[model samples]
Target: MCELLGMSANVPTDICFSFTGLIQRGGNTGPHKDGWGITFYEGKGFRTFKDPQPSCDSKIAELVQNYPIKSRAVVSHIRQANRGQVNLENTHPFTRELWGRYWTFAHNGQLTDYQKLNTGHFRPVGETDSELSFCWLLQKLEQRFPEPPQDMEAMFAYVAECCDELRELGVYNMLLSDGEYVMTYCTNHLYWITRKAPFGKATLLDEDVTINFQEETTPNDVVSVVATQPLTGNETWHRMKPGEYNLFHFGERVGGNVDELADVAFAEAKPKSQAPTEPL
Candidate 1:
């Protein structure tokens, strides 16, 4: 399995504090090391950095740790590859163009026998199952809606339906963003923490570092962080159930519910083999 990290904020905010702890898990604190990648969205433009090396040791990851690039939405991943070779193309947090926007996605679970799905609009550049799933998702989205929906409720429902199909294959926790907002789904484990008026110190669970956000953030700032597991030891994170999905915009939760997308039949559809042979 892999780990996912995502962010959505009312104000432009850097992910350094939370990312430092997450990178440590790539090799230092956990064994998810295969490759790691991150994306920072600044308006319509995006800046991304990736490395096949472990995040704990990758100089690129170190640079990300120091860079204060700000964004309203972001998606990142630490890969424990299930399908595909350990190469740049195999990294998670893959990107594609959709509705004239750069849509990014990252997966934290394996999908067995998922290659059966047909991707109509998007195609995979890499051989990873994660990328395959992403391509298929976008393809279906395009087919369902020839253009971006004027109704967000319908769009969110379609996205949830795609996630449900993937969830049937296996553990399918994922994060997706279109540079403005974030959509997250949980098939097993995922938690989220939101920071608002009452800023405080946050201690990393993987790294021995703590940050006092109050010193740097404004009273009106609101930032939300989503991760496979809780990163901070002090924050009160909301835990998502097995079949759950959440939509966040400007750091506030728009709509979410486990019951909205829950389907017990899909859980039973999980492939018998969820574990991989080795990382990548």
Candidate 2:
């Protein structure tokens, strides 16, 4: 299985803080050392960085850690090599163009009989079950709507249905985005945290680093992060139930099969004490 990380924000926000923790899992703090990749969406265009090497030892990962590339949406993955070789071609966070917009996808968990899925126009460049699943999903969407649909809620519902089908094959926790909306589905382990007004400090669980978001963000800034596990030790991350789907736009949860009462409980939980802040 692989580990996934994603972010969506109302304003352009850098994911250096979260990325710092995720990279540690790629080799240092965890066992997902096969490979890693990340995609950042800037407007309708996006850029991706992939390395077949473990993220903890990759120079590119270090550069990304230091550089603050602000974006509206981001997706990243660290692979453990379940169904594919450890190579650049099999890295996660795959990208393809759809409806004149770029779509980015990253997935965790392995599936059985994924090869049976027919991919129409979109084809996988690698042998990973992750890439093949991504291609098949895009093909289905294109078949359903040749052009972009005006009814986004309907489109999101269709996406959730497609994900449900994939989940039937195996665990299918995923993060997908088309530069505007970030969609997530969890079959097993997945958690999310949203920060808005009255921002507080957060401490990374995998690293001895802390950031005071209130000093770095404005009162109106809304930022949300999703991961296979909780990235911050002190922050309360909402754990998505099995077979749950969520859609996030501008850092707010707008759609999906969510429990409203659970969301309210998470919102009411008090944050832990703050730690000393460090520059990113």
* Best model number under lDDT: 2
lDDT tens digits, residue span 1-280, model 1: 8889999999899999889989988988888889999999988889889999999999999889898888999899998877899999999789899888898999998889988989875778889888989999888888888887788756876798889888989989999898887989999988876788778766666766767787889999989888988887655677788778888887987877654323322111211222222210
Cα-based lDDT at residue 88, candidate 1: 93
lDDT (tens digit, per residue) of candidate 2 on 1-280: 8899999999999999999999999999899999999999999999898899999999999989999999989999999998988988899889998888889999999899999999987989989888999999999999999999898777978988998999989999999999889989999988888888778778787887878898899989999899998888766688888888888997887888986338522323222445434322
Model 2 residue 173 CA deviation (Å) reads 0.4
Task: Tell me, by TM-score, which candidate is best.
Answer: 2
Worst 10 residues of 2 by lDDT: 264-273
What lDDT score is found at residue 77 in candidate 1? 96
The TM-score obtained by model 1 is 0.91
Deviation of model 1 at 34, angstroms: 0.4
Clash number for every model? Answer: 0, 0
- Candidate 2 clashing pairs, residues 3+ apart or interchain: none
